[model samples]
Target: MISLGGKPLDIAAFEQIVLHQKDINISATAIKEVTRSYQFLQSFSKDKLIYGINTGFGPMAQYRIDDNDRKELQYNLIRSHSSGMGQLLSPLHTRALMLSRLNTMLLGYSGIHPETVQLITDLINNEAYPCVYAHGGVGASGDLVQLAHLALGLIGEGEFWFEGSIQKADKVFKKLKLKPLSIHIREGLAILNGTSAMNGIGGVNVIMAHRLVIWSTLLSLMINEMMEAYDDHFSVELNGVKRHNGQQQIASWMRAFGDKSKLLRKRHEYLYDKKVTEDVLVDKVQEYYSLRCVPQILGPIYDTVLNTEKVIIDEINSVNDNPIIDRKNKNIFHGGNFHGDYVALEMDKLKIAVTKLSMLADRQLNFILNPALNGKLPPFANAGRLGLNFGIQGMQYPATSTVAENQSLSTPMYIHSIPNNNDNQDIVSMGCNAAVMCSRVIDNAYEVLAVELIALVQAIDIRGISSKLSPATKWLYNGARSIFPYFKEDFAPSQKMREVKNWLTETDITGHFHKQL
Candidate 1:
């Protein structure tokens, strides 16, 4: 059970609630807060009231909603606002949003009844999520349209994703033996009026970005092995001079990941001096820059991941509803908790880091594909002239496209906003849009890592035919081989790349001896 007393929602509990399908429970105090907020709304009929409860919303606020019809008014708000234009958000995202909205309302500040919170909670603990569209939230007036669909489902008016189809809410509620919530004044406004979609998406992203950081570090390890970069670059003294925390972390990781002899041997021997014959040229330089500079390039990405985590954790705990009930102070105030600037900027920053990470993976994959970079391992593209050439050629186009799409999608969404709610909302938060864009960036990054997995395996396979490669390379190589065996001839690799990406999700690399997880 997670408490929601104007504190950040617990994201790990949410993950278990959805991924593991856990039960839900609300605190007694949370139920009281919602009751107090509801009572406060009921007490203020004669005073100049808020537009959402007794008056019309947005441009229509000039017209007052009648007391007898307040319940209908809230339902109408939800029905009208369910005007989302795009496809539905994925089931994972929809479930996350449902839980987020429930947790947000538990702060007891949204003037909703305890039953309302319980109703939403019932859907979640019962493995039910209201079907919400992918678009229609600007993030300023609290994800408006997207959230409207969620509210619509709660009131038995809209549809829900059940089994495989979008079923009418009433039918599903009955079929699943669930109780439908009775409409209350301003319940729709409160439910659909916060940054839940943006927050939900941001929560998932925190996990995805964290995974990408691990994958990028592992990819960097693969490149480092192929490049034979100077272990001295990872030396404690070299990084301590700058005192960059992330740099120090990267260096430490490199030190742990490098050849065991590199740490023990007092004298570093150049392969050129020891092994290279008179046939080589250009100093037979130690691996390309892509492989050599991973710590320098991706160390900052590690720091960005850390910052993104802080943003999500802070947002999760904060009460994001308008018209918060300060029952402790006996004050009812409506303000700007609906604003999504906080989540949008964090997602934009995450996208930027993830974009660079995918590009880095693609570059490393490129080096592994080339024999010159692989160094006496395999031919360019690593297919090894099956008949003549095949595997590498087909895979290259997809890798290139993934990198380009990531670059294009990383353009920040926070800087752009369109006024909505009839100028009442003149400035908006593009937080929901940021979530969508960031999700796309992650999809693109997944494919990039997939291709890198193929290339890393190939580089190791050819190198290993003679002498065993670094222990780290073998770990990654064997891991990839389990899911994606070496391709000696032409074949479709889309399936293989996907397998590698999924492996990273469940496999804990920190448990392994090698750094290339």
Candidate 2:
């Protein structure tokens, strides 16, 4: 079990749990510290009002509640805010959102009891994934609707999908011989008051974006080696002139693949090894810029993932609760720790990065499919036989459209905001929108990557790169070739591409290399 405090925790570990792996542990010391914060908040009688814990939520913040009605207040919040509409998030996204929200509260500054955190953890560990819808989160004043749905599950009033059936949480809890826990005044506020849903979707996208980075690099090399491109373009001496890290990295991977090409033994001014079958010829297409500029284009996006990871780590490790307890200072301060600007901007950057990659992939697919542009590569998905088979000509149409759609969604939601809740939600982060939009970007990327996979595999086959592929490239190419079975006849390519993209997402492409951190 991974140990979490109101401080250090592992994101990868959290991801595993959200994906239905295991539970996290809280150190006794951490639990006690959290209890201290909880008790201090409970001691309030009068004059020491806590904003969310004892007061009405959001625009009703000016209203206060009597202590006797505290329990009803929390339950009422959950029941009322459970107003999210539309289809629920996918099981994957829902699980991830729960994990992210729980981990955020694990920072222990939320003035919630340790028991509360433990119950949430227990619910996740037991596979009681509550129903969380895609709509109803404006990302300010927290993901109120989403969190309430989650809370509703815990209180046994909402629905859940467990053991492959849609069942009530109360039924499942009882069948498992467990009981849903009661809520305290702050419980609803604690869970619903942050950017967890956005973070989770963005987190998964970050993971997938990371894989595409390496895939792009590998693809550049494959295209270069297949064409017998001049090594002069990728010379370290030449790349050093530009000194762009991603460009240099791409140049290195390309030349390295070129070094391993079956056609060429070595660069000029060097002795040629005797490993030659002179079958390779000049590539008439010369490969599009999309194929060649993989590193210059996708590398900085990799760098963006690195920076975004850092910012998110800080956010996750932070005590993001309002009314932060400063035990040492013997004081508490209510502040705007709940704002999602940091995550929102980073997610926007991520959308820009991943969305650009989709368009880039789409561009390459277009170059490969168009006979006019595709060199000797067969027309439109290598339909080997011409008129009888369209061989994914239609596939490329939507793939091209997908790229433009992703580009359109890349507009930063953080920049656009409308005041809500009587200007109380003024300066909204709209991270809820960003999170959902990035999810769309990721889905579009799935289609884009799928199209590229189909195109690349087809290109390699037409150019006979498979026969001359490097060991690593050959391993991957052959592996994917088995799943796709060479696309000999024109058929729907969508399902096949989705399966291929899913495989890449699950497989750790980064593990194939040992590079500097």
Candidate 3:
């Protein structure tokens, strides 16, 4: 079990917990801090006018709530705000959502009861994933409605997904012998008022983005070697002069892949290697931009994914709820820590980075499908009678369409805020939308990469030189070929591409290479 407390939580461990369903617990010090903060908040009276305590929320803050109705007010707040609608988030996103929110409360400033904190932890430990909806989170005031839906499940009032089926929260709670959570004053607002939803989505996106970068580098190296492109573009002498760390790293990775190749040839020595049966013609003095600029294009994507990961890590460890309780100083501060602008901007950047990577894959796919540019390979890598069967000719359509869709989805969401909550939130951040868009872009990029990998592998087979492929490329080629049997017919490749997408996401592509190396 991973214990969360005063120390920093790494994203790797966080991923293990959320994606792998590892158990987690609040640290001892965090439990104490939660109790202290809750006791301090409990000391407040009905007339004290703390935000979301005895006073109303948003534009309704002017209305005062009586002591007897404070609990009802908090309960009603959750009931009304649990208004999210749309397709539900996947179980992984929902699990991350709970973990992010729990991490926020564990900071000991949200004034949430320790029991409620444990309740959330228990939900995660039990693998009880609430069905958080996609819509209703403007990301201005902490994803109010989306988180409220999460809170609704905690109180045994909404639905949850358990054992691959949707069931009522009450029934699941009863079966698990877990009591329904009670919402005291300020607890409802604390739970619903934060960037947990966006952070959760952002967290998953960051992981996927990281994978995409690695896959992009691997595929680029594979394509480069397959085309027998000049290795000077990724040479240390050229990239080292730029003083760019990302470039240096990608160049080094390319060298590792290229070092094992028999196909990588110097420009001047095309006939020296005796392994050649056919003299591959050198048509151009220099490779095209897509083939030559892998490091340059992927360098920024690496930096962007890392930068976004840092932002999301900090957001996960922060106390983003309103009315932060200063237990030591006996003071309260009400501010918009709940604002998701930080994650919003980073997610937008991630979408763009992943989209560009997808475009690179699309460009490579286009190049390899054209006989003129593909080192004399058949058009679309077709080996059969050209008119009787089309090999990968039709597969390019999905890659092109996804690239176009990703281009449209890359528009930033931070600049398009509309006023809501009676102008209390005059300028909002559509962070949730940015995160969702990032997720879609990542998925699209995966499919594009899958298609590119399939097409490249087919090209390698068409060349009829399995011995010429580098060990690293051969490993990837074998791994992918295992899942997606080499295409032999003209049927649509959609089903095969989908299966490959799943395999790529689950199989640690780069990690496998590292282990083999």
Off by over 4 Å in 1: 1-8, 45-48, 257-286, 381-387, 465-473, 505-517
Instruction: Kindly list the per-residue Cα lDDT of model 2 for residues 326-387, writing each as its tens digit.
Output: 55456777777777788888889888988887877777777777768756666776545788
| Models sorted by lDDT, best on top | 3, 1, 2
Candidate 1, residues 182-294: lDDT per residue as tens digits?
77667888888888898888887777776676667666765565544455666787778875677778777766655552212221565524765666654334446666566
lDDT of 3 at 369: 94
Deviation in Å, model 3, residue 423 alpha carbon: 0.9
Instruction: Note the residue pairs that clash in candidate 3.
Output: none
Query: What range of 10 consecutive residues in model 2 has the weakest lDDT sum?
Result: 264-273
The list of candidate 2 runs beyond 4 A from truth reads 44-47, 232-235, 241-245, 248-259, 263-287, 381-383, 512-517
TM-score of each: 0.90, 0.90, 0.95
- Per-residue error for 76 in candidate 3, Å, reads 0.8
- Give the candidate number with the greatest lDDT: 3
Q: Per-prediction RMSD in angstroms? A: 3.4, 3.7, 2.7
**Tens-digit per-residue lDDT, 106-169, candidate 3:** 8888888788888888888888887889999899899998899988998888899887888899
Candidate 3 to native Cα RMSD, angstroms: 2.7
